[model samples]
Target: MKYMKWPVLLGILFIHAVAAAQVPVVTLGPDFAEPGDGWDKLMQLKNGNTFYLHFSRKEGLVVNVYNAGHELTVTDTVHAQLWNTADIESTEIDGIFEINGQPVLFLQQLVKYNPVLYRLVLDGVSGKLVREDKLGELPSVQFRSVFVDDNLASHDFYVEKDPESDYYAVALFSGMPVQKTDSIHERIQVMHFSPRHELLHQGWLYMPDTTYSYFSYINMAVNGKEKVYLGTVGFNTKRNGSEIKPKVIFSALSPDSATFAHQVLDYTAGFANVGGTIQVATSTANVYMLLHVPAKQGEGNSSIILNTFQLSTGKLQKHVQLVFPELARNMEMNLGYKDTYKGTPQRFMLNQDGTSTLLLENFSFFKQGNTQINKLHTNLGDIGIALLDTAGKENTTMAVSKYQVITGICEPFQLQRRSKSEWMFRNKIAALNTNTYLSYDYIPGQSAAFVLFNDYLQYLDTGGQDRVRKPLKYAVDANFVCYRFYNGKMERLFLFGMPEVTKGYACMMGAADYNAAVGTYATLLISRKGLEKKANIAWIKF
Candidate 1:
């Protein structure tokens, strides 16, 4: 691969001049004139020849269709009800390969005080209702994210299980209940459905005891062998109070969910009272857990622990602890450094070659009077690339320069390998009062790393030893990057979306190209918007 230098490069200068000549054109469509106060949820769906957008307002939920020319072709009012009663909390569209091989849109309707889970499927072509099925009585469970697997004939569902049940007792509480009833085991249920929506597997995870106190968050992941990794919170009730332990339990299931094997990862045993997130990447067999330790509890400074475990051997490779040194010095740093902290060391980017980069944010403090106020002035996030040597005793650690001061927010968006020595990072940057976000893809292949940011990708070229800014004419929203030689000129292809501004929050943008089949590709955007908000998915075709 040929590595290009940044800044002083003639190619960058030429591109900048071309980008300056191109004006951003914004074409507005017909207004969605629904009498509503706040527009909360928005989802975009693309079929073969059409695009569908579904949005919810204070009034009801509406669906609008558009063509490739950006013209609104069809409008459908899916459902309407009184302001307080009707609510569509979640909507998912899946391209089902079976059953006539059509795409189906599943909308989950939730009444404010009801416990029923309503399911509705919309036809992909006509935008009409194909079928509606009531998914029976559900628990008083809060809404979580949903997933649909096309290759597999089952839909895996996960929800918060009740803590007072016998299943909860065995799986989490670490103690058995005095009295066990039939209803106790039915408190929490994990349901798996067949292709035709038939119940395949439904049962509760056996717990130790039926205690009112248990861990809060529960996340599920399926490994290569189809074993379910249930990352959950476990609690122990002693003479004092309930102590929470963050644990990842692996459960092996047979085809019918009748026979199973279970094991708890002992590496995560000591993690107590920490409430963070866990993600497992099957391709790399790496499990990353973000732990939030409380500072006031004398648990030391709050930090994120990156645990690398092998799926084949079920052994932990390395446990790296990430902590913001500056943030730890501030007395005003509360538990988990929730307030007055920009970002934690939880941001991670896993490379293809088993190497990874971790992004950590630190904060400084200033004394006003009797009270001390911690201010996030500097972003101490550095990219640490770790490579395991054959001896395993000598692990190489390559640290990059610290990033610019990003106030109170930072995230690892995209990490691309430019060359043998260089890597590129496209991070989503945001600050206070500045809603605009940009992408900075750093090319580490060359001597002077070049960072591509926003429309004008800026880079530092060692060839000229100067900084240069150029306009990258490719569309910004799509995940896939295309380069082609047309008429002796390099042409880039991209799909553009509406520009959005972040409000008092930072966002992490991620993009990847997945090959669905031969000559077919899907561009996916896995973006984490707000810290507390859910990660949204946007898929486009090229």
Candidate 2:
């Protein structure tokens, strides 16, 4: 309930400094000795043990177990005959989770563009293989990025387990055929698995009909009750050819595959002028959708439309158009001009009492090039927060001031022009309570690019006259800040000064996860050394 300003007080500064000093850095194994491509994943088990998992077809799957003190205790490798195929180059590892006190690794191998999934469970202490089973597969499916979904709308492979029931399911989707010969087709394959990795039920669900000419975006989520929900937004060509009408559809598939329900959300009638992005979020009992609809009659501003659905009965519960007077004021005050609503929902935090927090980033693109060549930048304009209570009413709306610029190259390895430096502000937010959240900002500050290029703009502005732009230098200023939010207000907790990370150590935080059992925050880092890379997990305990 108390507020603290930035440049925090002396007592608050001491608290932050102490927490920063307790951060732990764990290094993985030595560099690769073989000449093959591989990836590593870090996972924490249920029994308070951690493991660094690395696998390559040539070397098989290896597990390096670390104790509570972050010391490596065991190293185990499994070289099964299943990975001896010739098409090993098309193999992909999804993720690692636990089953019956053993670590199970999920892998997908592509055979002629189709996918075959395999599950292998390893012993915790000895790293020996406990069981190896071939799960299911979807033929003729394409794979996308597992780390980041770049497509505006696409399906992702999900492997989830029900904690209470100890049951699991795998959902895989194959895109429609390039040549549309059929109107409706089976597009999704869902497989239910037991705790021992045995396939229980398999079903195929058909996607809604769409023309071959029209492009569609689809996203899916599975609930704890073993139900799969699909939310799709497509633009179909009208008969008069005057304009393309937006269509939105929702589908639900039950666990036994006996009951399938489909509902049309009045795509053409309700959202005749709406078209941007449709993001879907699901709690245990409800499905929520946030649509960035075009506000103006033709093309002036945008509006956020929130729709809630009952997951059990597949019924539309409520639909409300959210108003953001505070966000408009924040944009006008910070950017000196007001733009349309461009909030892209990234994180949806749901509570037990049915309240949800929708965190959005005002996203836009920047073109930085002259008449000759151009590059696109993903500009993070600002941050927006919306809270929806149990009644599906948006009770509060708040916008935070934050601007970020993303470049093409990963700044940890490559260098660009000094004028076009790659600035990064890494942060993470986690729910502290039903109505409060905490965000940690770890900005080891900006660095000037090592290279310079002034020809792109100079050629367009001066008719190819000047080439030199400015001298280049490397610079960095590191610091960290924390913020607490509750009831439509934000308070700066404290800011701590920090030493810069040495070269080859990519201090940029890739991901953050909270360990509920330990009550600590863990940050994942991708550290590179020339051609080799290491996975470092930093634990921040206060």
Candidate 3:
């Protein structure tokens, strides 16, 4: 006897309708110009009402801040004292967030030598420097990333005052420690600092073994409580003198950042040199860990795995694996086995619902008669988004709109989802054959606005494939997009373009927020081309 239920099916449809009603509409508008040179980073603030841009120029580094409504508010310049040589080290915008209810920006300046971290406070309206401070020296060691959390109330410099401190502003460094025996050894240290600029605690990560290790990414989450998550790579040397057998370790910090707990999430017993990158959301639902495992020893064939850990359980209970078997079919395609190689499968995103996505960027084949005329092997890179149900089932696979087969160096691709069924994709926007980076905003009812570097300015459909608008060539090196609502109509906001010294590279990094009254956006740009100088800061108003 078979039974059929109609009421249950009807209830599902009714619930879906309610969900759809809650999703916001996205609208896009015509492009406008806001200008600068050698732009690099962007940040949105005041709920998406203001924008900050930074860039570098031959003369020095420059910054421009503007309103999302297409108004220029503040422009400031910082001269780089070390621009004698052409080769310059990379610089990064460390953190931009509110501290004590006031807006502050932290810039991490790295030259060829040791790194120096600088802190600058910005007046919310004009983007002027309210105050400035230089933090501390980083022992000439390499750093993977830096973050600022307002919840870290204790400073690292004053740890002796209280051994049971709950919060400490921290800096993570990756490199080898100087040895008295004149031998180099790898080490990772977390330098904790107080809110008023004091060192509290500094120590090496005590691992179970003597294997060389490095820290890559830091994920900080703020809920009713605060938590810090770290991703690490562990490797051991083989008897043949070659490094082999790598593993990934996941570590978590207590709510107060006083104690540490860790576990081996993935064991690289079969795969060699496995590593991962992790990111935690502002909401502490889950942690996204992107794991990379090479297929062979010192070979290029590799797979990307996305693992999700339930914070409550502190265990990896879900994973999505992506493999490319075609790499094994060709021998000449082999390259030095490393995680940074282009065209390898790279894990992109891990959504809130436990769905994960990965990006395949490069394609290669065996060289034949002519290197240029060889049978072109289309990589046909793919994006996969999967949902892991609470029952631990891989139940759904979300459809990803395909991307075009782009040649030459491509910028890091960006992905955003508007709804359960809709997603957006765009690579770093740059010049022809030159790697390009792009910054964008996706409004549900509005269109997706992307700012690219190349001489050409362009727009793509939601799928990131169809060209909705033709290329508008501009002399600026970087650009960003913001969304504004006026009289019930949504509009796209554009900022001035800054010239970049690197052909296809731009320093523009930005973010946005939306609420009831207004939407605020901000971008940071370096106005110069070379690395030996500090970039200026620009704040945009919308």
Candidate 2 lDDT by residue in tens digits, 149-232: 122223335465543344666766544332445333445566766666666666655534342122233444455456656555
Model 1 CA lDDT for position 459? 23
> What is the TM-score of each predicted model, taking all chains together?
0.48, 0.62, 0.53
List the lowest-lDDT window of 10 residues for candidate 2. Answer: 429-438
Prediction 2 TM-score vs. true: 0.62
> Which lDDT tens digits does candidate 1 get at residues 73-151?
7667665222222433332221111122222332233344334433445555555556655553433334332211111
Every candidate's lDDT: 0.32, 0.45, 0.37
Q: Can you tell me which runs of candidate 2 are displaced by over 4 Å?
A: 1-40, 54-62, 77-96, 99-102, 124-129, 136-166, 178-185, 207-217, 233-246, 268-285, 290-304, 327-341, 366-377, 391-497, 500-508, 525-536
Ranking of candidates on lDDT, top first = 2, 3, 1
Per-residue error at 13 for model 1, in Å? 11
**Model 3, 254: alpha-carbon shift in Å?**
2.8
lDDT tens per residue, model 3, 21-62: 222233322222333333343444543334443343343334
